[model samples]
Target: TSSPTLTFNDGNTIPQLGYGVWQVEDDVAEKVVRQAFEAGFRHIDTAKIYGNEAGVGRAIASSGLSAEDIFITTKLWNADQGYESTLEAFEASMDRLGLETLDLYLIHWQQPKQEKYVDTWKALIELKKRGRVKSIGVSNFTKEGLQHIIDETGVVPAINQVELHPFFNQSELREFNASKGILTQAWSPLGQGGELLESATIAEIAAKHDATPAQVVIAWHLAIGNVVIPKSVTESRIRENFAALDVTLDATDVEAINGLDRGAEGRIGPDPAVSD
Candidate 1:
């Protein structure tokens, strides 16, 4: 079955469940991405820092699928946050991805201390105007960072991808994004598969639904309306994670998962507020 989609503020729809290639090495990205495609994933999230766009491009080329059938998203590195630099970096990314027009492009981080996100956002705006990218957004942006760019350019981001999971639900951020018509996309949706996956609570819920803990967590993300991209290099795990689209969590299940939020302590990534 096909995964569901969420409409961005710009009217573009992204598959609610996407395949992420964060830690996957460039040499193996093509293989695993192709396997993800075979497992029914239509959206792929990559970044220049990941060093795998070329491999992803190769997979897309060899997948026997049309460009329109896939939603490709990549980001601008922190070092390239100036307007001119962002523009040049984008063209370089396009060359690596081998795409004439990209589906979505994002400023990877707010880099608030540098105070360049506003200008970087303008470059994305210019890309959209030129039809080089269909939609533009940001990742790891705080509410203040988001507002800064919006206040400057009067352009709200279509999406904000961040570290979100049952352990660190990011409810406040999610609420803020919703209030601004922005879609919240989850990065570490499964809590990186350690203790969070082994929790007795998730295990119980998984057993109740006859699904894996990862799937249950993913289902929880969907139940609450966040776009989720779970990553795995193993073929079976890739297929299993994609099958999460079929796992339906009821109100009780979702509430139990919601209670697992660990607030700031559960965040597994760099704090965007202080990140360079």
Candidate 2:
């Protein structure tokens, strides 16, 4: 039941396995989150755009777990990508989450077209100094986008969350993050659904370990030093997702899974660095 952990640039450690709430309904998000907590997940990832922060807050408050025992992460949306507006948006997110401070806060998108992400990064840096957020990072940022923020602020983000899975390993961006000491957090780490889970290659590996295909893939992510947050509303699935930490994939198995990467990405989500 021991989950892996990684130390961030800010000297804080985050559990490698996290429960992500991307499209879960607010009403269901709380119950599902509670299930995840009870299942031994210490990290929870949410976003302002998810519209479930209040529900997530309720679950965290009622979990009977001390706040210090959890690593909670939330993100700011695109429209809030500026200094003052980002500050206000951060406040709104904190209020919704019912937390005085966050373990980590991230920019949900790069939105370079808006040309305000640098200003947003500056605001996040100030937020860190103000002690409102422990660490700051970005999501959907390309290497160039991350470098832009670093060049302007002179502060490297603690993480960069992006779309990652066995199908799209993101080698170059991952190398870039590793070189900069930024953690690469994977959203949709399982792909859109159970498609990859049903693959014969994954199934064979799962059989060898007496584990599920999903768990096999998650172990692959962990072996590669990537952070993974797999979302699910089903209580059983939540429990199963947490069990991924227990399944260790061998190098040969990892290589077999790594072979699945297309080099070209099968990204189900938009590239927010360029999207509207």
Candidate 3:
């Protein structure tokens, strides 16, 4: 199967299965990003806190592909969560990425305790109006948090990036986003390489399809209409991650995967309200 696509509320399209460079080191990010591009991945997700924006920029600049051919996303860190500070942070990130405009820029997290995310969202709207950012969204935001931003700003985010995998499915939150026009994007879609591989259901499905467990899990995500960013510094795993598009899941496969939803009670990352 070919790679799938998800059209955002803004009408722009992003590849459903993309490459993520969350913890990749500066020394390796550029090269790995290039490799992911060569592997046929058109979307690349990174963050300012990941400490590899400069490297990601180098890879994009040298990829021999036009900037418009790639869908690049980066985030503004929590420390930079005020109106002016958010503007400054966005400019700095663009400078590091060597891009005049970004495909997507998201608030890295909703640090509610500080109560500055609303201001930050306002700044993002300004950035969008200034033509410095093409699309804006949030990461690590709950349903309540998402509603708070929209209720305050009257702007529906184009996407919501969260930690989701077979073992910790976020069905209710995704339903809420769908109702509000925000596309659900999965960050740790494979449980950071742990639970996904250990899933009995995944292994059985892999056997039935003659595919790897990772591929089955990723295909399952695609079948359910999610944009997944699976990260890997290894060449083989990168190739394997891309191959997930070829494994088509049947109704049984879909049901088996859907049964994994953990309801309103799963978390892979710290709750932002108390984390800071």
lDDT of 1 by residue, 137-233 (tens): 9999999999988999999999999999998999999999999999999998989988999999999999998999999999999999998999999
Q: Considering summed lDDT, which 10 consecutive residues are worst modelled in model 3?
A: 264-273
- Rank list by TM-score: 1, 2, 3
Clash list (residue pairs), candidate 3 = none
Which candidate would rank higher by lDDT, 2 or 3?
A: 2
Best by lDDT: 1
Provide the global lDDT of candidate 2 against the true structure. 0.91
Regions of candidate 1 where Cα sits further than 4 Å from its true position: none
Q: TM-score of every model?
A: 0.99, 0.98, 0.96
Q: Highest TM-score: which candidate?
A: 1
Model with the higher TM-score, candidate 1 or 2: 1
Model 3 deviation from native, Cα RMSD in Å: 1.4
How well does candidate 3 score on lDDT at residue 168?
75
60-83 per-residue lDDT for model 3 (tens digits): 999998977888999999999999
